[model samples]
Target: MAVELDPQLMDILACPSDDHAPLRAGTPTDPDADVLTCTSCGRGFPVVDGIPVLLLDEAIPPADSASTSRAGD
Candidate 1:
């Protein structure tokens, strides 16, 4: 089953980072997965068992330049 979040809660969700910018819902890799992305810092937070893991330690940083950049694209 797809992990669903309440629209009302999503509206108030913000990044726990220093910037504390609003978070955007991300496309989950798995049906049971849910993710929230910080627009300002480019950090991603995972949601487990339908609960968003907003902890800073659990946040994933944006992809490195080496991994995101291609030789020619």
Candidate 2:
């Protein structure tokens, strides 16, 4: 089930990536509607059991990003 986060919490939440971009909740039509998407990096952080998993390793990067590695990687 898709988790609904509080507006206040959402406001404080940001992507864990180096960009530290703002996050937007996934739309209902999205396959990963339970995720929180980074506005800048296009990575999706999963929300599990009402808790957001903001770990970079757990984040799903954008499809196009798979072909490219980060600067250090």
Model 1, C-alpha of 25: deviation from truth (Å) = 0.9
* Clash-forming residue pairs, model 1: none
* Residue-level lDDT for 46 in candidate 1: 88
lDDT of 2: 0.83
What lDDT score belongs to each candidate, Candidate 1 first?
Answer: 0.75, 0.83
Error of 2 at 22 (Å): 0.6
lDDT by residue (tens digit), candidate 2, 1-73: 5559999999999998788998988833485489988889888889998899999999987755765666448
Clashes in model 2: which pairs?
A: none
